[model samples]
Target chain A: MKKLLLSGMLAAALFFAGCDGTSDPALPPSSDFTVTFKALYDGQTLEKFKSYDYDTYKVNFSRFNTFLSDITLLKGNEEIKISDIEWVDFTPDSAFGNLTVSVPVKFKNVPDGDYTGIRIGYGVKPELNAKRPNNFQSTHPLSRENEYWLGWGSYIFNKVEGKADLDNSGAFGTSLVYHCGSDAVYRTYTFNTPIQVEQGAAATVEFDLKKLFTINGSWFDMKIPANQFTSNDVGNVIVATILMDNFDAATTVIQ
Target chain B: MKKNNAGWTFKISTFSAVLLIFLMLDACKKDDPPVEDRDDDLVAIPYNPKSYTIPKPEIFPEVPVPPDNPVTVDGIQLGRRLFYDPILSADSTQSCATCHLSSGSFTDNKDVSTGIDGIAGRRSSMSLLNVAYVSRPLFWDGRSPSLEDQALRPVEDPIEMHNTWANVLDKLKTHASYPAYFRQAFGITSRKQITKELAAKAIAQFERILISSGNSKFDRYLAGDPDALDDEELDGKLMFFDEGGLLGLPDAQCFHCHGGITNTGFSFFNNGLDSVASLNDFKDKGRGEVTGNINDNGRFATPTLRNVALSAPYMHDGRFNTLEDVVEHYSKNGKGVSNEDPLIRQLGFPIPGTNPVKYSGLTEYQKKAIVKFLHTLTDIDFVNNPDINNPF
Candidate 1:
């Protein structure tokens, strides 16, 4: 009878605890992380249809979009994941002059803490890249029909599209499209800087798109038009490699 | 005594006949379906809405179905009927099919469609074939975002069907078949519950089902059938897709705007259609008028080339009558305007001092081959799909 009474008391304790409308004590307090990715030309925010100086020519960017995967913050050996995948679209419907053409990816339930740095996997990782659009639902970001190239048997990892006025003439004539794709083009970069993830506020990380066009000191020449880079086209692969090598230098923590 | 007995029998027989008549009348009254709402009339029909899986090309992306309006079998049927029915028009002489015909891959085969009031619309009737996956902000100007919203426009368009929603509602409420259809499709309890939104939803469901057959020669070739395309067609396909760039063939650059499985991009582009003096001088101001952006002048939604061979006269205004003409137009250094897509300006071979874009690189033979290749995109199976045909 003592054992039965003890059991009943335990059951009552569990029932009342569940009905208290309180969260589990075991889980840590988490906060939302808002990471804004900006596409830029040189040091300023990139604007579509606006002319910018590239070498001797004036250039215009029509599109600049990339898929950032496995965005995680590093705290020593520990990692806090922000997003598995984000289709960062810098291609605005209209031109925004001075302001950054950017998209913010918000992640909720991020365990608040101070972090060493952040690591971003550029392009869909090998595992997710293996699957087709049909593998996922329509709502999945990777299910974009236009991004997936049947020729490459993979998603087009990055699109840096623009036109260059080869001559200083008024008309912008030359088209340059460097749509990098394939497993070989997939890469990741770690920005090794202190990042703090607080409970109420968001810690931002900025990726400059202009850095993708340059490495060390040299800038990618837009006059060299090799539009077909969806697959391992030799002419395009050379161009794509130049840009992919610059990925590490492109990103950094803003705050 | 005998006469009294006979009188009693006659009276009993008369009473029995009257009782039987009364019971028969009562039975007849009970058998009639109860008028739930006497004024508007209840459509007494079974409302078992079966889910519909819109036929999609295996090579294509997932068919985009809005969250609120899940497709139903009855909904599709009702939509199909409405699409072909002329009753939606003010004059009862035109329908959605008046502009979009199935045999022509949902194009009326006219340069610009003449509306019910005999007025010509500014743009061509875009092909409804494979429109389910069309990158959003639909229509040439990107004015309407959803097919449901787009379906509502023509009926009310002064030059088009030229009918008000009020008139359409009244007609649908009183429609002998539509009320029953509404009950089956949307589970409307009464005919009065028939709404423009429900009608539009039904039509949207029907439009979503109008997808590609994916049995085109290009699709077959991509699906690993090596013999699907001929030598010339293969060459054209290679050039069009810039696969020939590896083989030292010049990038035709058709895929820049018209790439992807559906042969179209997701955004609006000024495809160098007209040589405007300036952005403001554009006669139509197509996408510009919609967005209020001067840079967007002369831009139109990039259309799919699934059944392009049948969908001429081509372009937003249906300017190009034949595929050959279309190719020639692209070959020429486009009349350079401020916002003309760079792809057009870079059409020709690069020369030393002269703007390489100024010259047309495509030889006469190459143009023909490209046109021949475009023919392979014609999906006869889609055009002949009986499921999407006129319900009438």
Candidate 2:
């Protein structure tokens, strides 16, 4: 046993020494490249026109936050895998109004290879996302972790929550909810301009919230409908698709 | 002649002394064999640490306590008594131990848990073991963030304990034994101090003591015990870790959902259970109700796989009665739902042309091996613990 131990140690030492003498240290080489992805939104109008009186607007985005297993870096037509994409929710106050969720993506350990474009999605995959409870941190808002108070919704790729005035009803209400989840909430955007990216780095695509309401030749008005945004609305699906489109266009290649 | 006789006697004395010394040395060397060497043939007897004595309190991510509700010896003692006592119930006929028995892995061994008045709950009662180390959200739907918050839900639910906070507090305040215990745990004797909030905190503190992640067979092997597991068990562990499916797929993808040292990612998943009928047929709307997203309709939180060998009737609905059944469910790309996750579509084993299903690639024996590895997670100490049992 003593001989075996000694021989094993000697063999390991020799093997390590040989490798150290022959092979160079594998430090990731840095390079410069631009990564871009569009921040798309629907050109849908708000309900009651010319009303910004409320402190918070609840935009009912279709559930697009779930089913996100990984986020990728798309260059032109090719997809590049980036390991680090941390999404943070921005709350104006304790009431959790105006949820500004940001996904900070870094392309760490990628080698120089690029052409055009960028693509990223929210949430994991289906087999993972299924059979779950709502709310990000814990089961209840009060029980949630201090850092995860904003709660991570499970639906991926679409958000649909906002007040809209149908044919000028003239009743004003405030809403800022944007629900995005898995079911039928999907979109694919082909960018006009292709973006480039290199290895060992990453870039982010930040979508502007205000532009999401005003993009399609109309302004987002505030008006409440009879129904509180329920789980199975087809309109939520449309809203989710438009957001995916907006994101695809809003992506700017970072150099 | 006398000189020759003296030399011969000296030589004989030296030889006898050398032999005596050798015998003594051999006797000292045989004092005690290693504990492992003596019990090398013992099967299923864990490589228990000789140093292990007391059960350490496990620290978990969620179960919060107000600065006032810190865990103490008196508090744990009082909570353990209360947990075993039926006084917390409306009729005083059933206690927390009725459903959460220690022998049944802290879960009532039934498909669905029965509450006060024999009311059936929407879901099965989950095991309370190792809950302290859980970083994932609580409950089947991931609702109710902390254990303190979760404790109150079962109490208030009409189907559960059937006792409201107002009544529960009043009962505890009036009880002869409970008031004194409460006074020791909390520094107050008044009914206001013994509110439902205090009850939740005390119960949560006690639940935190029910930590189970200890020296299991698998843990022993991982901790470098060469003889912790038999050959077959070791092979199963290797197959479970490797991407090659064990039974149906190329590698037992059990590691994917049930990963990490504790096992189970605490993530939510739909394992094709809800696709049988209408999406809303189940009571839980999953993440959909919370996010108001239709896509999250059938999702539920993944339970910890620690002690999974003992905790049967797996899945959120408790539909799969056995571990093998659960494996079979995942083998087929979970009941095909429209917008079924792409990851489910990708399940497959290394060996080709077994099932012809692209994703689920495992062999029959590999599945059994993976199951064998899972059995090693059972900690006998936890199963036979005297402290976590009925203190009252």
Q: Give me the candidate number with maximum TM-score.
A: 1
- The residue ranges of model 2 lying beyond 4 angstroms of the native Cα positions read A1-100, A103-255, B1-69, B242-249, B276-284, B289-291, B339-342, B345-347, B350-357
Tens-digit lDDT track of model 2 for B1-392: 89999999999999999998998888877885642234222322222212112243222233333454566766777778878887777877777778777776787767888887898877877888767645556777666767778777776677878877777777776676676666666655343457677677777778877866467887777566889998778767765553222232244445534554556454555555665455555467775555454545676666767787777877765778888887666666555553233234333432345222243345576667767878898877886888778876
Q: Pick by lDDT: which candidate is best? A: 1
> What TM-score did chain B of candidate 1 earn?
0.89
- Mind giving the per-residue lDDT tens digits that candidate 1 earns over B170-214? 898777788889889998778778889999999999999988888
Candidate 1 lDDT over residue span A191-225, tens digit each: 88787776555555555656766657776655543
For DockQ, the strongest prediction is 1
C-alpha lDDT of all candidate models, in order:
0.79, 0.53
Model 2, span A1-255: residue lDDT tens? 999999999999998876632143574343543333323233222221123322244233321222223455466555655532333332111111223333343444454555365444443344434423222223332122221111122332233333322323332122233445453454433333344444434554544445644536444343332122222233344544455445444433354
The alpha-carbon interface RMSD of model 1 comes to 3.3
DockQ of 1: 0.39
